[model samples]
Target: MGTMAELFAGLLEGVSEAVAESTSLQGNHLLELAVPDDAWRQVLCVTYRLERRADVPANSFRLSAQASTPLPFLVQVMTEDQQLINQVDFNGGPPAAAISGSLTSYNGQILHIRMSLDGNPLVFHLDLGQPASAALSGRLLAFTLASRPLPATPENEQWPRSVTRQAFVLGYEDPVTGQITPPCRTMPPALSSSRVRQAFLDLTNLGIRSPKVFPLLSVPTDGAAAQAFRDALGNVDTDAVVAEMHQGRQLTATRTGSGAYTFRFVPDARYTGPRLLLVETYQLTSVPLSYGPGRVIKTFTLLPGERTTMRVSSYRRSSQSIQSTSSVLDSTSDESEREFEQAVTAEQGNSAESSKSFEYNAQASASAKGSWGWGSASASVSGGISGSNSSARQEFAKNLTSAVGKNAARASARREVTVDTSMDMKLEEGEESAVERTIENINTSRTLNFLFRQMNQEYAAVLHLVDVRVAFFSGHSESREEVPLAELDSLLDRVLNVPRTAEVRRQILDLVGATRDLTGNTHPGFVRTQAPDGTELAPAVDPTYTSDYTTPDGRTITLPGIVTAAERHVMRTDGVTVDAFLGEGQGLDAYSTGLQEQALRAQAADNLLKEREADRLQIALEIARDGDQKRAEAFRTLFMPTQIVNQIDHAAVNTAPVNGKPSS
Candidate 1:
């Protein structure tokens, strides 16, 4: 298979042939399933009848099979084959329980999946041009691969260990240096357009337009440092949208009596992968002075083998401010319009990451002046709700920087990244702008916009992948055992049907290798991403949200999106920040030249209208004096042009002076 899409298609064929036996492609709903836990057969079979959701066309995009019930949520697979089979003892003594596998390639490679562990199968990849930081193998243990074979005991005495040893390391542990290196977990494998569409529906709790389904690319933003913004500045047209979806119940308290209620979350049909469910409830017992609306927050991860999570939340807030007289209380008031938001956020295996918030305002003030004393105290609180550093290769950034000749004025880059970067977190710490108001909660697209300046730092990015075939009997190992074709067929089918992140790491690294530069603002830049024909990419379109929640609040309480309210906020663009920064028909068009043109056109029309009004008044005066239309018309023509000979530019006709002065 030349591409990831082709690779998955080839795998789906194998799975279809093995499961259905006959390669009849009619009414196929092809899919590579990561088998759910507690499956009966390492090799099992069942007969399934087919049904069509829609009438087929002459040519249609179809899957290999469609089950009556949707795929269930996947739990960790438990089997007896996960143990270490062979040994590679680095010290020539005992095989370390965990080994640090290296690529033996050059240092600072892009997307280096440096190490892996047995339990956490996801490969942890390092960013390009990262520092030469190695892990230390501190301690040694009798690893299953390196240690001598254990003597066979009675079945009841000890359980059998799994035997699947893949040479990989999360990182090297340096005991002497006392350094504990860490790596990012492998990303999810490539997904199909259909799969992504289905996942989008499940994650955002929204539907898509018909006949406009584009292939949704599975992008990785892990370890990428991005300052979250909610404004339209960075909104990409025809781009993927990442939103964190919440599924739970809403409960409220009564005026009195027991005020408690609970809601259970249901798994979505489209998202059959791992899931995380967070349950929460906000409580506000009364208004201020007697305000019982309280707030609480907690985070939760999905537990293995668990389908549901249960949580209980209870809160109350009461406060009062009063102006006091010498012996009695006076001028007391209650706080009004108090609101609280209780959010339950669960990011499922990176399906999506999103946030939601509520506007909360609490204010209290009291003042008193008497012979006893004068005192004043007031408090006001406004509730704002919210919401990877992908690094550049050291070599790429340093080398490209020097390429800009000394004659060229070097521009400083604040932060530069590809628009396709799906989701990211900021790696730097700072206040974005001292003059501009900082957003507190940035969940909306409007509020998430980052103010940035174009810099001279330029970069080029590319994505590429390569695959090589190896003979299993000889290449996989030195011939520990031989297998039958039937078993071999099943294994091949299983590999294709499952999502393996190792493959993803390889592809991402390949992309990094192909790219000359990805992100940075060190050197001066005038580069723009272009097509093969050298046409610059089109301007980004306005982004759409999963849903607009601020409409209900209206102008009285302006509630902005929370996606941008990220603690770390700001934008660093590849262009300048001035009015003339962008060229014709580019960004800032609506607010810049667009506004100037309208104002100028209006002024020119107003001047013409005044001239026309003067001509009409002059014609009326001439007609009234001469008592003839033709006479009035001739008088008007005398002032046809500005340079007329003997021109006396009089606005209206007049009679001879009655005494000393002429009168109209």
Candidate 2:
């Protein structure tokens, strides 16, 4: 199932479109509030898709929203009075003009929205057809290592003097690669329930390993064009691929059996050559039909073994559904749906996780880097945050920006053009002017902030960095050592994260081209910590605690096995929005940093309180060690608990070698 965030995005967009078509509001208003820049706990938005057959001059579209109930968050479309008015007054001069609008709420009601866009902003024409609603569906299979047959115990033993504890390690294996993936284990729900145990049994019995439930597609290695895509598949810009795939009204994912999916609606077939994008979605809202308030996409990787592992379960229970919406089962009436749900308690404790999705759907949502355990980094950063040291972050941002700007400008100022010397100098100067104009469009701050946030999470983009360590002025001491990242300490982690795991593994084995050499040496690129030119950074750091996932039999496993994929829909809800990237989220980054600063301040305050406590205890100990004879004698004059307790034989608190009694 999609993390709660994707669910809300897809559902809200669907609802908004349905409402737009259903609403009485008019005009060519094709405004969709699906922009990632705008967000909410649970919100609905109206969007527009324009279509005009011929060139025209001046066209308009307006869409309005009205709801009977008070909507919590209505982006773009509403005013102070909750009055929504989205209007396209007129596109002037040019035959066609661009349009942008905000959003309002939506509901079950579906509408027929008429859209028109004058290719030249001249004459407007309407396009018809119901925009399809996109949904996410998938199956969740949770598993654990099969228990080694317990050392045989006496068959008749009933005393239970020796109890064999079952060590519960939570995660699943990949269907295609047999690699085990461990899910993030933070605030897990109650586990003592029969249902969860049932799930465990169901998954354990499946016997298949590896979550690459989707069957592998063969990439054409013969054709020149095909070969190029195949070669680049090992390392490509995640955002570019996602952008290309989502460049339409919808992207469809069909289950091709064995819990695998094949995607459609890709603008370029070459992109689908070696890499596969998969997303898993589940409902977040309890409301029977509402998509949800938000979704959660903790981590995803171009490589499958990044954040989540997949296991194929051919054991589809006749009517059984376990925390998923992607199962093939007939839906019973609302009264009968309850039959599938029941609470599971740990064998001992009452604490447990809620059984949410028994079925789910997954598709591609590219994550820049595979999961690089950031808990230690977050902790270490807390130290750097002390004393309001914002200068470091600011300096880094400035330096990075300066470097990028210089490079862009330098590339643009290539005076050595292979030009006909006879050609006018105006042509070259005009090109320079265009380059200058392009600079105005680049929002460095927006791009920088996004990069900073991504850097804070994982640094796999520059996979050459086998070690990540950096020195910071921590309050504890200058140059104090810190353990930050331990799991992502090798190339194995990077290789697994690359798409087309099976093919990549085969290539590495054969040592073909850039693959591992006959000596089993990894790709040449695998032997570096810093980029050749040193633009990329791979900090050398360690983990806070010992992180070992080796099996009992000495089989070592690599990290980031678990990945979070989301359904790539008509509208994106699970990514950094266009508006945000274009400077809208500029100050938001600073705000986030401020929040981090505040958190550090809290930590500092906590440290201060602890120091005071220690000092206070030390002073008390010194006073006692010296002499309080006079004070003790005076206190004894009063009827104290020590004296009173002695008389009643219920004494307490007088055992500290006082009053000449043998210290009891």
Candidate 3:
């Protein structure tokens, strides 16, 4: 009865064959099937031939199927004892049977069959159509039981379908190496619902029946490439290999009947040398249609019971080889270093050249000097005589003795001297012109005034020997040895032992106090004093007493007791007049009155000058204030257009002459 039903179902199979042959299922493809009878079984068969075409890459094609019928009355291909064998279906109007098993006799094609009913057993079979490679053979077996049935009705009649997906084991023999390379198998979609129970059942069936030939491809095993495949798998088992070609790295393994069997490999081909091999698989399941802002798409990933594939190709590292290609880097660095050194040397050479030029100019100017020479022989003799005191005096005396004789001689000599001096002056002027031309490059005021100030300050402590005063003295008659008043001991005692002036003492005390504030000590040694040379000034003697002394300008200065009492006096005695006729008091009174009058006149002049200056300033200030007021008025007038309009309106209102009512 099952065989007849199978035949009848096969005859009633729809045109899905043409659809499957033409269209490729990428994600989930939806199809609807009708059950003529509620109790009748419906079977679906999906067979696909996976071919390696020159255009299509490896592991590019796959096949899977599903049904939308109840499970109990499902039309399927199974045995009478409820054990699935080949192709069969339940009694229905046409006994719809799907011929969906393996297309390739070996592992080259895949077939997936699904049965939908309230309660039904799915059956499947394969037709290679032609003899296939012996290495490409696979089998279909059933081990897991189908799910139990539930009550069904016309409204809720459909039951999730059962599917059987099979992957054929196809192989090819290398002509040279004589090693067989297994054919690629399509991967299965990760199963989410129990409707795909038949698909996994199919896989286990094939694996158990033919453990040696069936291959499970999985992600690559190499640590580097494995992550990529694992990521591709997403949430799938990374350690398991699903399916692969024969001559490839083990991707995943499965225990069929007893022992574990490899299901896939990385490189699918066995090569004497090296070759790239790829194994691919995929999983198909009904994914809920997801809707976003604008579009809807069916998303999928490599999952268990789903189809996935892996590929391996020949590879080599080129980074290291490329790095080693350039060997002259050190030589390039050395050349760069040499260039840098040359640049530095050139800069230094230029600097030295500039310095040398300045030095050469300075030396050339220093080698030249300006000088003046005596003009005439008489002038030279006079200068010599003037330099000798006795000759100068004798000459003056002789001239005084013969005044007329000297005057006549002088007149004649003056004429000759004037002529000779004029000629000699011309000669000297010519010499001076030559000297000016020679020494024209010299800097006359190159020394800055600030630099002179610094030099003076620096040398203030150095006393010139010529400026030092020496005192001469004789000892008492009782003493046999003559004593020099300017002895070194006496000089040291007078100069060094002298007490500081009151001002100096106050400065010292202030310095000491400042030092103590900073260093927490009042010791004199801690006080810092500076000399002209920026050196610390050491006290020549201990500070014993402080006194004040007047400066040379008669300011009534004060100093310590040890300060010398040397009053500075100018020679005003020569200017003192001898008024022998006037009494002392009268002379003094006259001088005082004269000084007072002069002072009063000077004060009056100063007051008049100040008054005139004030008047001038006041006039200028008044003129400026008037000008400012005029400018301010002009500015106001310039910006008073609105104000003028308002004023016109006021005038028009106030000065409006009544047209007919005005009377005197």
| Lowest lDDT block of 10, candidate 2 | 453-462
lDDT tens digits, residues 1-664, model 3? Answer: 1243344335535335321111111110000111112212112322223233343222221222222323224333332234332344434333333333443333322233334433433333322322222212242221112221111111111212233211111222333444433222222211112212333333443322122222333323455444444333343332333322222332333221111222333332121211000000111111111111111111112221222221111111132222222111111122222222223223333443222222112112222110000011121211232223223222322322232122223222211101111112244332212111111112121211100000000000000001011211111001111112123233223222134222223322332222111112233332234554888553322233333333332233222222211211111000111111111222236676688679889999999999987886676577577888665545445544342234644642222224545432
Q: Higher-lDDT candidate among 1 and 3?
A: 3
**Model 1 error, position 123 (Å):** 18
Model 2 residue runs over 4 Å out of place are 1-62, 65-87, 90-361, 364-537, 540-664
Ranking by lDDT: 3, 2, 1
* Candidate 3 lDDT score at position 380: 20
Worst 10 residues of 3 by lDDT: 451-460
* Candidate 3 residue-wise lDDT at 259: 19
* Cα error of candidate 1 at position 26, Å: 34
lDDT per residue for candidate 2 within 1-664, as digits (tens), equals: 3244465456556544342111010000000111111111111111122222233222222322222223221112222333332322222321222232222232111222222222111111111111111000011111111222111111212111112222112122334444322221101111122323333233234322112111112223345534343333324333433344333211223322232333333221110001101111111101012223222212211111112222112212222221122211111222112211111011112111110001101111121111111111111211332212122222222332232233223322221112111112234332322111011223223432111000000001100112222111111111112223222223222213333333422322222112211132333333233544886544222222112223222323232211111111111111221111233444347777788689889999999999987986675566578778775555446423443355565655454455576675
- Cα deviation at 659, candidate 3, in Å, is 64
Q: How much is 200 displaced in model 2, in angstroms?
A: 30
Q: How big is the positional error of residue 108 in model 2, measured in Å on the Cα after superposition?
A: 22
By TM-score: ranked, best first: 1, 2, 3
**What TM-score would each prediction reach against the true structure?**
0.14, 0.14, 0.14
Query: What is the TM-score of candidate 2?
Result: 0.14
What is candidate 1's lDDT per residue for 1-664, written digit by digit as tens?
1243344346545554232111100000001112222211121111111112243221221112111222211111111232221122122232222222332222332332211122423222232222111111121211111111111111111112222322222122233432212112111111223333454453223222211112111111222211111111133221243221122111111110111111112221121111111111111111101101111122222222222222221111111111110001011111111100011111111111211110000000011110110011111111111101012223212222222111011111212222111122222354131122212322211222222223221111111111111111100011112222113333333222234323322332232222221222211111123445978652111122111111111211111111111011111222222111111222234566667678789999999999998987887786897799677557556545343243476444444344556664
Cα shift from native, residue 152, model 1 (Å): 29
